[model samples]
Target chain A: MVEFNKISGNVWNIPKSGKMLVPATIYASERLMDTIKQDKTLEQARNVACLKGIQKSAYVMPDAHQGYGFPIGGVAAFDPDEGIISPGGVGYDINCSVRLLKTNLSVEEFMKKRHDLIEALFVNVPSGVGRGGKTRVDRNVIMEVLSKGAQWAVEEGFGRKDDYLRTEENGKMSADPHAVSDRAISRGLPQLGSLGAGNHFLEIQKIDQIYDEKIAKAFGLQDKDNVTVMIHCGSRGLGHQVASDYIKEMEDKYGFKDLPDRELINAPINSDLGQRYYRAMGAGANFAFANKQMITHWVREVFEKIYGSVEIDVVYDVCHNIAKMEKHKIDGKLKQVCVHRKGATRSFGPGREEIPDVYRSVGQPVIIPGSMGTASFVLVGTKTAEEITFGSTAHGAGRVSSRSAALQNISGEHVKNELAKKGIEIKATSWKSIAEEAPEVYKDIDEVVRVSHEVGIGNLVVRVVPLSVMKG
Target chain B: MFCYAPINYINLMPQTENMAEKYKFLQHTADAKFQAFGKTLGEAFANAALAMFAVMFDPADVKPKIEREIKTEGKDEKALLYNWLEELLYLLDTEGFLLSRVKKITIKGKVLEAVVAGDLVANGYKTHGDVKAVTYNEMDIKKEKDKVIAQVVVDI
Candidate 1:
């Protein structure tokens, strides 16, 4: 059992006890804390704090829940020179990210063609289990994708060139495809534009609320006057294979007898194997960026086919799971650190050079997607997060129930009918997925967003409600 | 739902015939978990593969139309189980096969060889979930006088 001390409003601290290098902090309210304390989230946070070169306290977001090695909302930063890189820090689906697009069409205009549009999207976006992509690339082309990311998609006419500017890292990472194994490449080649199953979706949403007028305007969001499209997917089979390959390598080279868990397998940051895994991870992340870009192209085409040519610009895209090298202040000195956000997102504040020029003064745009059939939010990063949590923020409403329990508690038909009654059109490959990912299985997203905003890690700009959802 | 009798030479041993009843699912927060049992390690390993695929779709719905041979060696029994399931997952992801049954399996030291049977999910058979990767978290393969049990948690 872990003991917590209330440090401030919406913030609690687990004291640095045992082998911890630093205390673990929990950003949650009393009500949310009850649920947070029920799981091993606190224990995982403590375990993360004990890692080598860990700086500051490990963070547990309000949406924290139990995961294999690290909690879903776990966030930690390690010194690049001395720290270790673990596959658990990045998760299996490397760069499982979200991209939000703003359209000129309003809810009233989209409602007329909602069903047809959803059907088109469901058919166009290859989804479900073991499904291949709509656009198949050869080995040579897939290598380019693994290295170039979204830039490859734009070059292939999948999306516009400017779309990369709105994406994180310009939708490109310094990926070395050669670091990836041939098996991973084989899995990725046939799945370039496909959406894998479980919590991945494509949804059409309408602006429901705008919290800050200026930020919302800068994001091109107008409450009740504009609609948007959100794509949630990842690197598909390729990323999973890369992670699996690396974990085995780490286990084979360095035994895990002393480690707390085998899943927390790692190598020194400067080691050859560590460098190789990082490059492979980058390649996997690139695949995800290109995957989302291709889907964006399909989304644009569907809109064009239904409602002529209209404005559809990308607001911003953020990765939910990744470990990237960044410069942050530690002990009053700027240090290069590898920030591992397993189920968290990078929320860089204003003045960060990585952000685009259009939003440079306002900070990076962070998209926090709620559960299926629930409200999603658009927020901006804050400097406070950089000071407290390594410029990281909560990813989403983390799951609260086991998949088995969820299936037993809710019926797919009931969830479908209930959403339909609320006027939300859902097109899914299987009703079993609907039952497994029912909104009830997730934590309260609104409250999760509230804690995030109240703590100043991420501040809200606009909220959107789903009008149609297409799931794999 | 699918059964493959051993060759006439091994018909004298009946313990492996009904060991399919040994596996059952376990509840995990975000992933799928299962525990498989057997009188011998080979049967336990076979049941573990079945439990892994059972979470993705109903094995009864899959026809044993395709047969594939899998061989992998690990440093130990635990590593062997991890590699074995990973090999099966590779077949499912790369070949689009859904596991229906295991025809035969032999565990010699750290080496595992098995003949798995299933139909192609690409043949229009439906699946309920996707098993992303098999994990070593809480993985256990234990041997006792009467039974051998293997437990695994797979990322979905």
Candidate 2:
């Protein structure tokens, strides 16, 4: 019933109206239209279009849904010349992402060790609300962590340096720790290595189906039977407090008079307010990278202890929602712009200087994880992705229902028993968690992955089926 | 999915009228009930203290009433609320104390001022997740034309 200015099949535009300087463009499938019909994400899209100096169209991916300001599945690029950066756009879990680690161990091998492996992981990695990690770092060391990210974790005996080479932005962007406030450091003190509650999980999966054998072999995913661990987490309380700290400042200190949602608080890109927020946000990003890296070390240790030895290796770690400076061809001229991807993964195609050398021919490996009971995917970047979506693709199966609604409709205990019936062992702190993350509450991931393929954003590699799951 | 342990009990703090004197024992939903009213935010915070204590036993039952002072400051009103609630929770967690009364309170802008008086005691135990932070998603700051009506979504 609402009017949205049309752009093209790959894009739908929201025209500049009432303080808007740019149009909004949403990239979605025909099926995703209904979800947008029921929410204000479209209006929010238009609102983002209104922000000053928006370099390109304010964009939303297929998984777009209502969030604090810009939709969770949203993206917007701002002019380094004249634009604004908002913490709400990046969300509280700054640099929250998924990292895939492939092991020589296969599905059949995991089946033999499933019960013990799942149980050991559950005990080793602390899960649930207000949980503290088994490791701790002092305030000074944490500051270094804010600046160095996974490199710090590796130097601290967490993982190998090569793990950084395969990660986005080398696991740490240019973060200046002095910009971070002590409060952020304090809030993050206890959350290091903790598997915080909600949406965050560590799933052990096997490569079930290989769609592209040559590309799969090139990316260290050679075996269709090899197992890989996918860790999904974020900056924890540190990032939450960082975003919380900035939102209040943006609301009270810097006021954008006519933005649609007050939650979409922002500041001019070059201003001190903007600079401080970005650096602190980067610190949070570092915290998240370090967190996953530290956990990676423990994961390896646990495997070694149980299996006597592990021939495991890091695959790739990429952020789902983040903002980074990149050079892309616009009007056949290369221009450097800041790309803000909210709940979207970068699918940089071939020959991009930023991508690793091994992936130069096959494009970057994109890991798409479904729920514990559903099938996950491994996809490769494509040239079509670079031309159409700024080299981005859908992150995962977007939520189809609210948490409360899910609780009312499904029983956690029942879902657990059902998954067990499927031979997937579930280890969690509480059944409430199992209910909250029921696979049914999310969009059909297979459909989502299918759309991405049809759209030519990315091509499917292999399907990874779960043998066991662990959640916070 | 966000989940909470449903509240299944009848308990409220006693109240009196005349602004400072008027307070009520109220349950907002399946998870939370508090003595939420005030001549000001500080008074309302004080009542919240009483409500926390009442969750365990009759507020009237705690004998030899003792007193303590708690102060917390945050970047904004919402953060202020979190720290304020957390301070009270720390007392309950560390000191095993439940507050029963408030002698005085004041709220000037974001600065919440209150003097909470109570005793160190135990009440009926219920398995509860320590409240982490308050959320702003469904936060309510009701105002009837000009009068301010207080309500908020405290993330537990």
Candidate 3:
């Protein structure tokens, strides 16, 4: 069993041992730590600590939960010279991300046509299992989408040029489409704008509370009156294929002998396979960026069809699952490192060159979408985050119960009815899904956000509650 | 009336009923996990495919209206299982086909070929979930004296 030392309030350390390059640190309150200890999440975090070239410590957020190889809310940075890139660190959904759009319509105005709006959204956004989106493209177009990302969508008339600015990496990453396998491309071709199954969704929300008026105003968020839309999705099939292909390649070429787990199979950052996987993963991430852009366009059209050409500007788009080469202070010197954040969000602090200019003084917007019928928050990055957690924050209200266990305790019909009674409209492909994603199945969003705020990893700006939900 | 009573009544049960279950689904906090059991390696592989599809929809709801053959090669037994299941996912995502049954499977060294039957998604056919891909995480194929079992966790 792993032992912990309470170094400080809300902070614990798993001392470096047995092939560990660094220690493991967890940021959680005593109460939350009790719940976190119930799972193998900390064990996974300890496993990450053993990885080569890991700098500082393996960091786990307060909302951390068990995942395949890495905990859901895990962060670790590796030296570019000697470290390795594990696909599991990025998860299957390459850039599984969330985007928020502020609309001109107020809650009262939107409620007047809520039914019509929900219907239009449900019809426009192809959702659920095995469902394809409206856009169908051939291989050539698929390559373009992978290469140009959201820019391709804008040029193709799917969104505005300014939309990219609000997105991480401006909705485009340096990608090599040729490095991606044809099978991956083929799998993603028909599902361009789809909101895929299992935890993916599109929801309409209204601001319920504002903690920091300055930051909230900077994000263009208003109190109680303004309505917003959030889209939670990812790279879909293409990303999954990239991760699978690379993991297999690493096993075949590098061999998996002595590795703690096959799921952590990785290649040296500078190796040919590693570089190839990075490029391909980036391409898959681009596909996701383009996919969300297309969905945004459809959303705009629906709002326009109902409200007549209303303004809908993207507040921010942040990826929860990904790895990127970044420059950070390590051992009192700035060095390049590959920061892997699986089920974690990048919370770059104030004055970072990467953040959009408007919010540079404050920080990048870190969005955390809650489970269906729960409250989501908008937070800003902190300098402390960059120093402690590799500039990362919690991704979502991490799951506390298994899907099957949830099925036993919650009834889909009942959960749907309860949300409906609370004035939140839900449209799902199947009732079974409602049960699996019941709000109670997740950790408390308020507590998770409180820890994040108190730790200074991310500071809360606005909290929004669901007005309507579109589940896949 | 029935004078031909079997020496062992339990042994006289139908072979299908006497056999171990094809597969059983396990619970992962975020994703689904399963273990497939069979008396032979091929059966274990075939059952693993069923478990993957079962996570998406009830197998009873699907019919063998369409048939397709698949062939894959891996460096080892673990890779072989990974390749086989991934091929099934490829079909689901590319052709919108759901697996009803594995008609046949043949494994030679690291290569595998199989015949799968399913139906085209249409008005009568629908899927209840989407499985993104088969993962190497906690993936293992074990062979015992009387049976073989394959364990896998899929990213949904």
Candidate 4:
């Protein structure tokens, strides 16, 4: 049995044992801890601690769950010269992220054209399995997208100049197109600007409460009834292909005979293959940024068509899965390390140069999306997070049950009707998806965020509930 | 019954028993996991494809209008299975190919060759979930006296 020692009210530690290089620390409340212990979450966290050059502790967020190699909300930092980089650490959807758009309209005004607006969004955004975008591009444009990210979208008249500025890494990272395979390009070519299915969604939400007026105002969420659009998606097939290719390559070069799990296969951070995978992963992240940028453009058009002239500015876009070279305090000195966050978000606190200039004083805006038809949160990063958790926090209300279990117990029609009664409309390509992603399958969002706030990783700013949802 | 010219194999077994017992989905919290059964290793791999496609859309509902030949290799049987499934996913993303059935499959050493039939997703067939990629997590292939079982878990 895995032994745990309570370090504090919200912190628990699994002491270093066996081949583990460091201890595994988990930030969760008593109630969330009970649910977390029911799975292999603690074991996975321990497995992460065994990786080479892992600094501090392998941290598991309150919303942690069982993932392939790492826990869903796992966070760890590694030394550049001695550490390893795994594709599984970054996850298959390279930069699966969330972008929040604030509109000038209020909830009362949006309710007037609710049905028309929902229908327009459903028609405009190409979603579901393997659905291509309305516009087709050649190989040249795909290359540009892999390099320039959201900048390409803005230049093509899809968005404004300041839009990319508010995104993480300015929505663009230095990427080598040559590192990406032809098959990856082919998969990403047609699917650009489309949202693929399974937990990906586009939600129309209205701010219901504000916890911190200063931070809420900083995030462009000032009023309670102000409407916002949240887009949750990722790099699509291109990212998956990059991850698969690298995992195979890594396994071939350095077999998994010594590793605890095959999915944890990796290469040294400074190795040639590691650098190539990083560049290719950056390209996939750029694809995701471009995809969300195009969708934002269409959402702007839909709003302008229905509500006349209006403003829909980007609040912030946070990457949920990524590995980045960052400077953090290690052993009482500032050092550079490669931080991998799988199913987690960077909660960089105040004065970080990576944060946008407008919110630099308050810190980065971390948007935590709840399950479907539930309350989503807007939180600000904390300095405490940087000190202990490598500036990372939970991603979402992690799943507690399987998709098959949800399918067996719930019906799509019943879920739709229940949401309808609560004034939330949902549209999807198939009923089976709705059933699989039912809210009951997820952990309590309130409890998860509460632990984040209590642990001082992410502080609550504002809360928003979905008005309508478009499932991919 | 559907027939192909390259490999003439008749489905003489009863439809209910053959179709219903080919695959069964297992429980996974955040992804799709399933177990496929067959009389031979090749049949088990083919049924694994059926289980994967079933995660997206019903294979029986997809008409076999297009045929594609797939060839892949691995250092071992586990790697071979991983490559086989990833190849199908590649076709699905690039060509919008929805699997209807596997017409023929032959495994020699660490190499696999198969001819599969399906329809383009653009041909008005409604699809639900997207299987992001295949994983080696909890993947297993077991052989018994009269049957073979191949298990897979895919990231969605």
TM-score of chain A by itself in each prediction: 0.99, 0.96, 0.99, 0.99
Docking model 2 quality class: incorrect
RMSD of 2: 6.6
Residue A383's C-alpha lDDT in candidate 3?
Answer: 95
Query: A1-472 in candidate 2: lDDT tens per residue?
Result: 3467445554566776767777777766667766764676787777777776676677777767766567767777777668888887787678888899999876776788778988898888865554557776788888889999999999989989888888887888788887776767776776777766567889888778888888888888878777889888888777777776787688678763555665678888788888888888888898889888888888998888777678777788888868777776666777776677777888888898878887877799887878658888888888887776667787887777655455567887898999989878888766766776788877778877887787778789888887788887
The C-alpha RMSD of each candidate to the native structure, in angstroms, is 2.7, 6.6, 4.3, 2.3
- Candidate DockQ values, in order, are 0.62, 0.11, 0.51, 0.74
Candidate 3: list runs displaced more than 4 Å.
B1-20
TM-score-best of 2 and 3: 3
**All candidates in order of TM-score, best leading:** 4, 1, 3, 2
Candidate 4, residues A1-472, lDDT tens digits: the string is: 5789899999999999998999999999999899899888899899999999999999999999889998799999999999999999999999999999999988899999988998999899899887888879988999999999999999999999788999999999889878999999999988999988999999999999899998999888987777999999999999999999999999999999887778999999999999999899999999999999999999999998888887999999999999999999998999999999999999999999999999999999999999998899999999999998999999999999988888889998999999999999999888888888889999999999999999999999999999999997
Clashing pairs in 1: none
Clashes of each: 0, 4, 0, 0
- Docking quality of model 4: it rates as medium
Cα lDDT of model 3 by residue, A15-96, tens digit: 9888888999999888778878888888899999988888999999988988877888999999898999999889989999
Among residues 3 or more apart in sequence or in different chains, the pairs in candidate 4 whose N, CA or C atoms overlap within 3 Å are none
Evaluated at residue A90, the lDDT of candidate 2 is: 81
Q: Lowest summed lDDT over 10 consecutive residues: which window, candidate 3 chain B?
A: B1-10
* TM-scores of the candidates in the order shown: 0.96, 0.83, 0.96, 0.98
